[model samples]
Target chain A: MKVIVNGEPRELPDGASVADAVASVTTAGSGVAAAVNDEVVRRSAWEATPLRDADRLEVLTAVQGG
Target chain B: MERSASGVEHEPQEDMDSLVIAGEEVGSRLIMGTGGAPSMQVLREALTASGTELTTVAMRRVDPSARGSVLDVLNECGIRVLPNTAGCFTAGEAVLTAKLAREALGTNWVKLEVIADEHTLLPDPIELVDAAEQLVDDGFVVLPYTNDDPVLARRLEQIGCAAVMPLGSPIGSGLGIRNPHNIELIVERAGVPVILDAGVGTASDAALAMELGCDAVLLATAVTRARHPARMAAAMRHAVEGGRLARLAGRIPKRRYAQASSPFDGIATSQ
Candidate 1:
């Protein structure tokens, strides 16, 4: 399945959880957040939350700003 | 102010005062933002010199190649972080950004900023109100960056914002408090703390914000972009404390004519 991760399209295996999408990016243990289709998925639910095709997933963390 | 039986005048314990927002008491009146700094080392020095107990950081996409975390810097300094929803233009965007920040930073306090356009970087009053209401309902402590408009400030407060942070001018403009009367009016009527955020160019601006009765002053570019970030930060620290003290001391009223300091009856010259 194709999903947009952080504005970049990536191909992940079907039935991929948010954790998989997040793992496709950096593998930081802490200070990471996941959002699927503009809705936040709590850290505990990442493994349980499944992502389908064309899902907009945003993985964000703190940067120097605001 | 009071006088002891021995006639020694004593002033209020202004130094020990606290700036309270949503039941959180912050000892320092200066809140620093980690933007436009040359490096993390400089920011660390500035944050230390500014004496800010609480600071702000923005949330962005995680970079695989990114090195060093601002969170680590804050943690090393022992300063609490307040994540902000910057670069979001709509209520939904701000709310989602805020939620992401809460997830990433583990703090419910957010600096809600919804810019209307890129030209002036002004807050969209309509979008800001909507976002504040939503965030407040979602159990987040909202501190909105708004215009120096008293009416809008009041509206944000009525929407249950923890604090109304009115800009002195445009962000990073260094114009200082463009309308001090408006700030005064907002400070006068606001039930929550009024934080003077953005448009601060130097130490004097921070001091003036305090003197204008603001509970605290928040800035980034002013100190970060200065020739000497740490020095300016120290100056700001002193300015905020001094300004708060002046506000508590109460200045004398202005008069049309100057009164002679020495009474005529006490004049020694009889010419």
Candidate 2:
């Protein structure tokens, strides 16, 4: 299945969860929050939340700004 | 000057008041921003010099190969982090950003900025109020960045915003206090803390904001983009203190005629 992660398209195995998609881009224990299709997926549900084909995922963290 | 036994002059410490917002007492009235600094090292020094207890950071997509550490610098300095929704355009976007910030930073406090357009970067009052109401109901401490409108400020306060931050001018424009009367009106009517955010170009601008009865001032470009970040930060600290003190001291009324310093009868005749 193909999913867009942080505006970049990538191929992921079928039945891949949001946690799996997150792990493919960032190391474990990195401070980040994920949202699938504009809906925030809580940290606890990341492992259980499954991603479908063409799903838009946005993984964000804190950065310097006002 | 009062001299000590060792011949050193000891200055008495003035009684300084704390700024309380949403039950949190912050000793420093200057809320600094972490944007536009040349580097993290410079930001650390600037934050230290500013003596700000709370500094703002924006949420963005995580870069796997990112190197510098803003959180580390903030942690080492013991400054509290305030996550802001800088680029969000609508209520939904702002709410999502706030949620992400809460999850990432472990804080329910957010600086809500729902900008209307790219050129002005002003807040859309309709969407902003909607977002504030939603966030407040969701158990988040919402500090909205709004226009200098007293009605809107009161509306946000009515909706249970912890504080209302009205822009002095456009974001990053450095045009300080374009509508002081409007700011005064907001401060007069707002039940909650009124923070003067954005449009601060120099130390005097920060001071003037305080003198206008603002509980605090939030600025990024004025300090971070200055030629000397640390010095400007220190100046801003002093300006806030000075302005607050002056406001508390009660400024004299403006008069058309000059008041004579010397007694009229005490003048020596030049006969």
Candidate 3:
């Protein structure tokens, strides 16, 4: 499956869920949140949330920020 | 909802003790985040409310053909960029990221953050020091994101960091000042400005940090993710200003009873 994250396209495993997609890209124990098609997907729903072929997934994390 | 000066209503401005880094004077002490907003419109509005002069943003994994929108929104708002080394764990990686950010953003200023413990989002002090030294040598105005360690802060300042940002609490914990005494130590001893960055949850947290003599506060989740992002932003702006004013005013020594600002004892007794 293909997903767009922060405007960059990446290929994910077939039938990959949002949770799976997030885990694939992020480091272990990193604090991250996601928005799919511009709607925020709470952490609880990441597993159940399905992705489309060209879904825009915005993944953000709590890094050292201002 | 309303502000006053000398017992009279007045328009509000975020604290007067602005931070001067690289000769840039920022009006608001509360630096905000650009993430977690329900919409970009709300995010922009919240930034306006917070009266923030410095805002955080990240670099994108480029596809060359695709256009990123976050940067444009930030530029449109006219807030100064404090591009962070968000994902870099090693000193070399951080330096490279800082270089990339400078080239991409057209600013020599970089927020140097080297994360060691991914779970807690705690900084790697050893790596941060190394990165700061290298970046400063490279002519980047390094603002190191670090733990609340006075000795470490002094070390960074010695290495030419523009400012030392010590965490009030863990990033995004919404926990205000887990070790304020330590933060106070950093503030009192450091020659450069100390900005209380990360884990600030509310306006009072920002205020308390200022009252503790911190030069500024940088937070994102508290306002960007709030139930009322814009209102929280506004509150933080005022809170920073109030805290700064109170700090400048200075306080009377602690006493058994409240000391009156008015000359009650002299006036009534004399009359």
Candidate 4:
């Protein structure tokens, strides 16, 4: 299945979770947030939460900005 | 008598005028924004030199190829991160970004910035107000970045915002405070802290913001973009303290006619 992570399409195995999508990017333990289709999925729920095809997953972290 | 670093004697005012926002006391009044720094190493030095306890960081998509995180530098410096919604344009977008930041940073404090356009990077008053109200309702400590409008500041305050941050000018413009009168007006009426948010080009500008009665000044470009970021940061630290001290020690009123220091009665007869 294909899932969108941070505006880029990536192919992931079936039954992939939000955690899997985030792992595909960076391995930051904390200071990372994931949202599926615009609704925030908390870190504790990332592993429990699952994603579907074409799901827009946004993984955000703090950067140097104001 | 306690003395500040500048050698000015200060009466021991209780707490030494700590900046308290939403029940949290930040030691320094110089609130920094982590932007425009040449490198992470430079940023670390500048932040430490500024002596800012609280700093702003923006939330964006995680870059897989990126190196060290800004959060790590902040963590190492022991500065509290105040997440900001920098590029959002609408109330909804700002609200979502605030929530994301809260979740990411594990803090409910947000620097609510709803920009109207990219050219000016000015806050859209309507969107900013709406987002502030929503974030306040969501139990987030909202510090809104708004135009230099007293009415808007009042409105944001009435809606339970933690502080009202009005721009000295546009963001990163290096123009300094364009309308000191409006800033003074906002300061006069504000119940919460009035942080002069942007357009601080140098130390004097930061000092003037404090002298104008602003509770604090939030700036980044002025320091981060300087040839020597750490030096400018130190200058800003002094400027804020100097300005605050000057405010405390009220300035004499301006007069049309010059007054002689020596009295005429004391003057000796001259032949």
Ranking by DockQ: 4, 1, 2, 3
Identify the superior model by lDDT, candidate 2 or candidate 3.
Answer: 2
Please identify model 1 stretches exceeding 4 Å from their true place. B1-9, B12-16
Candidate 2's C-alpha lDDT? 0.93
Which pairs clash in the backbone of model 1? none
Chain A TM-score compared with the true chain A, each model in order: 0.96, 0.93, 0.81, 0.97
Model 2 error, position B66 (Å): 1.9
TM-score of the second chain, cand. 4: 0.95
- Tens-digit lDDT string for candidate 4 (B41-62): 9999999999999999999999
Name model 2 segments beyond 4 Å from true.
A28-30, B1-16
Q: For residue B82, what is the lDDT in candidate 4?
A: 96
Model 1 whole-model lDDT (C-alpha atoms): 0.94
- Candidate 2 C-alpha lDDT tens digits along B156-236: 999999999999999999999999999999999988999999999999999999999999999999999999999999999
Candidate 2 residue pairs in clash (backbone atoms < 3 Å): none
The window of 10 residues in a row where model 2 chain B has the poorest summed lDDT is B8-17
Which numbered prediction scores highest in lDDT against the true structure? Answer: 4
The C-alpha lDDT values of all candidates are 0.94, 0.93, 0.79, 0.95
Candidate 3 positional error at B179, Å: 1.2
TM-score values for chain B across all models: 0.95, 0.94, 0.87, 0.95
lDDT of 1 by residue, B1-271 (tens): 7889999557666545899989988878999899889899999999999999999999899999998899999999999999998899999999999999999889999999999998899999999999999999999999999999999999999989999999999999999999999999999999999999999998899999999999999999999999999999999999999899889878788899998887788657766
lDDT for each residue of candidate 3 in B1-271, tens digit (9 for 90 to 100): 3545667533344334468876788766777778677677888898877778888876544333332355656778888777888877899768867765665466788888999978888899999999999999989999899999889999999999999999988888999999999998998888888999988998899999999999888888998788999999899999988888788768767899876678665554443
How good is the docking of model 2, by CAPRI class?
high
